[model samples]
Target: MSKLTMPYQCLKQCGNLLIAARGSTIETFNLESRSLVSSWKCPSSKPLVSETSAQEEVTAVESPAPAEAAPEESVIPPVKRRKLSLSETPAEENKNWKHNNKGKNHRQAAASTGLDSPAVIALAVTSNGHHVIAVTSEDKSIRVFENSYINLKHELKQLSQRTMPKRPCGLAITDDSSTIISADKFGDVFSLPLVFQETPIPSKNETPVPATTEADSVLFTPAANHLTVHSVRNRKALENQKRQAKPKPDSSGPEFEHKLLLGHVSMLTDVALHTYNGRHYIFTADRDEHIRISRGIPQAHIIEQFCLGHTDFVSRLCIPSTRPEILISGGGDDELLVWDWENGNLLSRADLKGHVEVVCHEHGKAATDGSVDGLKIAVNQIEWIMVGGEDLVVVGYEAVPALFVFQLTAANTLQHIQRIQLAGNVLSFIVNSEGVVVSVDTVHALFSSSEQRNMAEAVDVQPLSTFVFEDQRLVPGPAFEGAEQRHEVPAEELGRLGALLYGLENLRKREGDGRDED
Candidate 1:
């Protein structure tokens, strides 16, 4: 993609790709012309309406006047034409929707060009690996990438139209890559159409269809089976009564519905697909700090059980290839939690305190900002838990472009770990069933282990390890409250949970070694 670059101008607004990098300050190349796109600053995932309403921006551009001015009255006042958006607002009433107009908004050019932000935090190729659906951490907007995941060389297309609940944290395209499901910070779950879109036939080729006066809606042509929702919860964890669990010999196998899976009090982070006794299920990652495995209908997406041990946010989850019921999760506290879908008990929690301790030992004391005791780090930090095709557990940290591998099994055990650090920060990485990990940095990408290690050990390796390790004061156990499984969790319970973490904080000593344990 780089060698083919030509020179091109920067884009007006690119909120979608910005969140794809987890709200980090990233510079994307105009690969065609090889020119650099502008830097993007993704605002937090607040309602877009909130920002628009609060801002009083300059509205229009002043047209240039002829140098030979004859009469002062001959000057034509600039047209007060409002910017038009096709999808939003009625055609007769064109209210502004997209921000920072590309042409003629001289008055508010500065604000529009302030930054180009990524609207999606996580993007996933569907189970069948056809479409790409992404969630923006900045605004919870869900953009369904228009290209199939079959070829990376294909031009990726995204629209700023589809949206999720709010503060979307995670996204998933279904097995067929047709349906998009995502989780928000509040443990709310949402679904959107992942359409296989195409441009209408050229006007010259075909007769136009009759146009309706009503605004054209973004519809899911092969719409979701909102009825016959036999089971909404995809977690195949429970043994259904023989009478009720009997697999219907229907052509489609399972039914579909627009059912609410559930909710968490804290922000939900991730969700995974599972199957039990030939039934599908879903497991959710939540701030309530629980790995909840649940199965039920949309109206009752119950939390069957929870794997709780992490003291902070559950950041990432990796489902295994060999064993469908097994999965691993990484926590904000640097701990990894392994869970068994069938059995809800905590499978294992890795002693990740050592990973950091060794780094601190090698680097002497961590670089402190000097202002706060927390080890100053990047604000939009992301960690990954990946499983290789042959059952290897891979831990990735964005701050340090590092990869750690462990032998993993169906029983949810990790052993014989190998560490291969890469140069620069691990901005993003992807692994498949075959034990291969492709890591991305500011510049180059490395797929082979030897090459990645060599890059990490390079003498001129640029470090992106600025992080602030503030004490994640143990909040109360209401942690999993943010996991989006069931929606009606009580807020009062969450408050009590917060109280628990606060008390634990006072009880646990902040060891000088930087490991605060409760």
Candidate 2:
């Protein structure tokens, strides 16, 4: 599915709780109790109404006071001021002004573009799950929240918010929680400080002026307002011009709060930081089927090597918690690739047909092996879970209405383990050691379409489901291959032999029937 069709959504797990982003709100659920702990509404971009109100406030504060009226006796008696009859009052004038500007059109456009209600598109949590960070589409801001895991509380406290110049699609927090790195729609990866610090003072004549707000930076001055109505159309036009006027990259250009670490020609979907053998590396996946591994921190731009085996847009990426050197990734392609990114070796790959049945490309259309296309089903999200002494990868899909689990076997292979059927397309999910929490399209989709529905009856709002697996299977006793079991075939092998014998019998029966006809 295209990004526009899919809402900005993500899932992150911490201890016994899961934090999920659904539209404009972030919700937390307790995996143990299978209950919702809390939900926090994310803030959207500042409203267009705020622009007019802010201008009015500025006028009230900055306008010059009217000259004191001359004393009646000192000034010649002006003609008795007759109250001038008017067709409209100030309120009516303002109402007509808004109507003439077609404010409704602007509001509708904002809604259609998802500007009015931006959602969280990316989220990350620390190992302890005590800290959370997310990127919102509307404001293009990164917000950090403190999770009360120790206190076992319902609410999360927001620590800080930093706005970005471009809308970010993915973000990664260092395991130490010291820095946050994000990939934006502009094909750029940037790093921002997680903790606030004081800005250093510039020497005399070196202090750079701060950037102005969006409205003030582009809108006309009072003297120039008469030239135009200053409606949303003009505002948009000015904004577009401002964006197009951005300077090309140069060494002496103004710096940003986020330092550019690297860039790509295609849109980046996911970013991750991995540490192996005391060395840190940054892994980035893009829409053009490219996954780059680079040296972390100060040498982030230094090229290491690209994991080059994907045939479609690489969307979801995860490093197994138990195996730090291994990387698992899947996108629109039918298969997921396992790689030793640290050593640049493609370890193994597995087809997803066992889990999801969907055409990878449109009928009669030749599939492009390494190009971005709209015809394929993509693995939307992935997370690692350890259960039953097995390292499992929980996979969620964009077009499929179910979740699949694959175990990373000790033999270094990806094996299908289980599938969890759901009511609607899986949007996002979080898998902790304890259980899993999933978010779907809607609660109504979970039930039969023919169910008699009451318009006002409250649906159970059951978008969140927690499934816990606490029973760790025990190890089996030793078995001798040459003993009594030597003569017996395993159930799996027996089934294969039975299928072969059945096919031979069918062949012999067909031959006998043909001889009789002859």
> Which candidate has the highest TM-score of all?
2
- Give per-residue CA lDDT, model 2, range 384-464, as digits (tens): 878877788888766456777788987667888677765454667666655666655432222211122232331322344
For each candidate in turn, the TM-score is: 0.50, 0.61
Best model per lDDT: 2
RMSD of 1: 19.7
Error of 2 at 326 (Å): 1.5
| Candidate 1 structure quality by residue, lDDT tens digits, 1-518 | 11111101111112222112322222332322323333333344323554254333323233444577768767566546454333234734433433433343222221121122433345566554334455443343565544422444334545333444355556655555566666765676665556634344447867776454333332223222335234646222122221132232345411223235677765576777666666666678765567877673343376677777767666667776556666677756656667775776668766554564444444443445322134322111222233323355656553444555566754567763665554443554333322222223422233221122232343233322111111211111111111111112232212211111111112222333221111
Off by over 4 Å in 1: 1-114, 137-139, 148-153, 196-259, 296-300, 365-390, 409-411, 433-518
Model 1 residue 489 lDDT score: 24
The Cα local distance difference test for each model comes to: 0.43, 0.62
